[model samples]
Target chain A: MSEEHAVPAARLRTRGLHLAYGDASIIEDMNLCFPDAQVTAIVGPNGCGKSTLLAGLARLHAPRGGAVLLDGKDIHRLPTREVARRVALLPQDTQAPEGMTVSELIRFGRQPHQGWLRQWSDEDRDIVAHALAVADLQQLAQRSLDSMSGGQRQRAWIAMAIAQQTPLLLLDEPTSALDLGHQLEVFELIRRQAHTGTTVIMVVHDLASACRFADNLVAMHAGRVIAQGPPDRIITPELIRELYGVECTLLADPVTGTPILAGVRRA
Target chain B: MTNAGSTRAGLGVTFCGAGIALAIVCLASLLIGAGNTGADLALATLLGQSSNEEARFVVYELRLPRMLMGLAAGAALGVAGALLQAVTRNPLAEPGLLGVSAGSGLAVAIAIALGSSATTLRISVAQLGALAGCLCVLAAARTRGVGSDPIRLVLAGAAFSGLLFALTSLLLLLDQRTADEIRFWLVGSIAGRSMDQVTAILPSMALAAVLILLVIRSLAALALGERTAVGLGHRPELVRLTVVVAVALLVGATTAVAGPIAFIGLVVPFAARALAGSDIRRALWLCLPLGPLTVIGADILSRVVVQPSELPLGVLTAMLGAPVLVAVVRANRLPSL
Candidate 1:
């Protein structure tokens, strides 16, 4: 078994982690490191604990064993508000209260910094403005989240996560409910954020999208890491069969020169 | 341009209609009474002097305070309900729904049973109970594996309320006087209450005000969901904790003065939404008038329905609130708080 202790962390690191929901154990004895300012994707089959792992790392789920380290310190020990300043998370199934405007949703990203006394500071306003500009949300700031198209709403949510202004962002299938174009809009934004020194870790189901976007890929099967490396190194037929139970040939995508899952027959 | 104008105009009409209802209710609360007093007689007493000390005393001192109590208590309960629903992202998540009211009731019931002055310490003790109830419910909501299901949260609240009610009942049973006091209080109403009761709950109401100002922003953030709340550097746990405490203080104090008036919190917010749309700030604003109108209207109805005997405010509220609860459930989708 390859232990991840040797991997260096720029922002977030998970050490010897375990988790469960009631009687059922979801993940056990897992160790992983998410480097800063890069895109890392965890891709695995449906029941492989991919979302669980993401949630655990974000402190949404407490681990029965081990710790998730943020900024080389234990994330669990940090106040939720304090940790939020450094890391933001986008959940897979996001729900907003009806009639929540895009700007209203993004403005929530400033909650930790705001209080009864310090509610309307200039810094708060400037940051929200900056986030809107970055997400191209200035035009639709007043539009309700419920009123927007799928792609626009997804953008609005991503704008909210970005407004969190954390160096590290963890997204669990942020594109699950989006169409292809909407998916691209969100992925490109995630990529742009990554390029600008924000560390991003996402759980994606599509191997091609994962290969195209992620600089680092972690593949898991039945709650164990089967492979972790660049897409080129981990795209073998056997690895695909182990992770996805799919029998497919891997070819280089001509456009992006990333690994593409092309197929023949079953294993 | 014309279509948008009509939508805005439609909203304007709704708001104006609510305002007119509010004005009429406020004036009518002062006008209508179960006693020998009438609007003309009350007005004569209000103008300066009256031949009968009894009418003057009832009009100026007794009914006025009670009406004010209804207004303030209803207002506070409505806002508390609106805020809790907004933050929990569940429309059913009212202070009373979450057992905060029961918590206050149980504590006060115990106090009264111990031969303590229930009327004197009504506000403080009730607030303390509310705080306990609020904390327990929110802590349970925050615990792992309790994802954002609207029904489950309400269920948890029901269990919490049931536990507190059981405790209250047990305490009330222990002493006859306490049972008398608790029984009178538990039915949830605002009738024949004195100005002293209103004075007792004011400090906590003030404290709740401060907390409300602090909580609204975080609550709006919370409506997005937890991961987002945390990512925004908001301590979701801390915000939840504050919300629990604030809800308890406000609801507890209101319950203390009014004796567990039910459904104002639920129906007021529901009415506020139909009038103001879904923006939390607007919903809260509309709740201020709608809440008092409902309580005072119910209080008036309670008086007139059976001339000499008044209906419990709780009964009246339940009557008003039941249809709302049904509507909430029958909607194509339950609106998130």
Candidate 2:
């Protein structure tokens, strides 16, 4: 638990955001607000525009009409480096150069904060160390990324985002390829990050895990937000059916008292 | 902390070792040549102990200029290869292999065919042609399915290079005077090129060096993938464009001087990465010295192997580089960047 410099959590929202790929419109007139310092998961069926929305929020995609706002200002209006200092993104399917170590990958997080004359400083080094510790990757810092397991590799990437030291972090399918144990490992780490007053927004594929882990769940259907609220208030059979065309029984987890989908199948 | 420190030390040692080797190779280049002047005489003349005018002329006027040309061209080609490979995120994205050299060669051949004899004008024409070649290969790579497959990109470049080579040969055939003037130059040699020609390319090389420094960090971020590089606040498009221009300047200037020397760009950077891992920053540092070392060493061997009649520098590099290219292709996996 190294003492990271205290920064105010950033508020992110979309104001009638319209996203498209060339001539095809994906998300049209979408309005949403991401609560500060919370784990918010955007869950939807495939091609429902959840990932596209995340990319828009991360400023990786430009809006076809409207804009994404950070705090009180339009994100697109700010300098790219300034936005990077406030928001960090972990893109899906990242491939680092072969033989790059965990520490080496994490050091790149400091690039936005660095300049030609001022490359490595004490602060950069400290932040990288803290990120490694936060991701539980301190022991594996020197190991090449290609030599690591999938779980460790994922953690290494997450550690890089953490090293960026941004108040808002956006991840696309953070746990899509992980096994149950690895998923839990990553989710728990995300929870810890959110608890530290960093805003965490992720696009998740699993409804069960999304309901279990997210403080707030946003369900999308056909390029629109179908339902959104705390998992307990929003995890209904009807919502489940609308999302996946599947019917599922809901149960309460005894330990955490969160909603859990059971006996799921197509309707 | 200790591991990182040790790795940094290792890189420093490698850099120093390469520098020393480059110096030795440079000295060898100055001493050895296809002439009556022997190494002992050259050494004596260098030490100012001998007044032999033939040794002085051979060492100072001929071999010195040739070595300088080798050093500059070698470094430019090596850096160009490293930059292209890093930007493309493909190990096979070599300037020579990807037709950049051939593009410049074709441009020079066309200029010579049109009776353009000015070396300065030739350098600019060569650079413009190299830029066009770079854009063509990269544009082809970016089309639909080719970008994802590194081999396909190389194949396209090979095809493009073959077409350019055919065009150059056609030009040579149409003009016998052009053929007589360019026959030896087209084979790629540093022999008999004057000091003025080497100095002509220095400004462009210096410019390329500065551009490389400005984008080195961004280029490393680029290796993490495009989206990631963008998220890191780097303009991937800008970084890529800068790299292409830098590659054009380096490869173009070198090709203008050395007549399309192949494989120094491929082999030098390949060896640099093998020694320094895949980080372009470290690999680039190694490339600086290794480029000169490889070129000058090959140049020395070319001079000594066939006595009285020297081999073309391009032929020697091609003979040495083709095996490396084959090894890269035959590897278990094409180590991405």
DockQ of each: 0.42, 0.56
Candidate 1 ranges with C-alpha deviation above 4 Å: A1-9, A15-32, A63-66, A222-226, B1-27, B49-52, B83-88, B94-114, B121-184, B276-282, B305-312
Expressed as tens digits, the lDDT of each residue in B1-337 for candidate 2 is 2222127888998889999999999998888888999999999999999999999999999999999998998899899998988887778888888999889889999999999989899999999999999999778767877777888989999999999999999999999999987777788988889999999999999999999988898899989998898899988889989999999999899888788888887888888888888889999998999998998899999998899898888899899999999999999998888
* Distance from true location, Cα of A215 in model 1, Å: 2.1
Candidate 2 local Cα displacement, residue A244, angstroms: 0.9
The pairs that clash in candidate 2 are: none
- Local accuracy of candidate 1 as per-residue lDDT tens digits, B1-337: 0111123465566667766887788777777788888888877777775677877887768777878888888888998888777766678877777898888998888777766775657677888888888777666666655426777787888888888888887786677877887798788877778887777777777887788767666666666776766666666666777776777888988888788887788889887876666766667767877888888899889888888777787887888787887788788988765
- Show the lowest summed lDDT stretch of 10 residues, model 2 chain B: B1-10
Give the winner by lDDT: 2
Instruction: Highest TM-score: give the candidate number.
Output: 2
**How much is A45 displaced in model 2, in angstroms?**
0.6
> Would candidate 1 be rated incorrect, acceptable, medium or high by CAPRI criteria?
acceptable
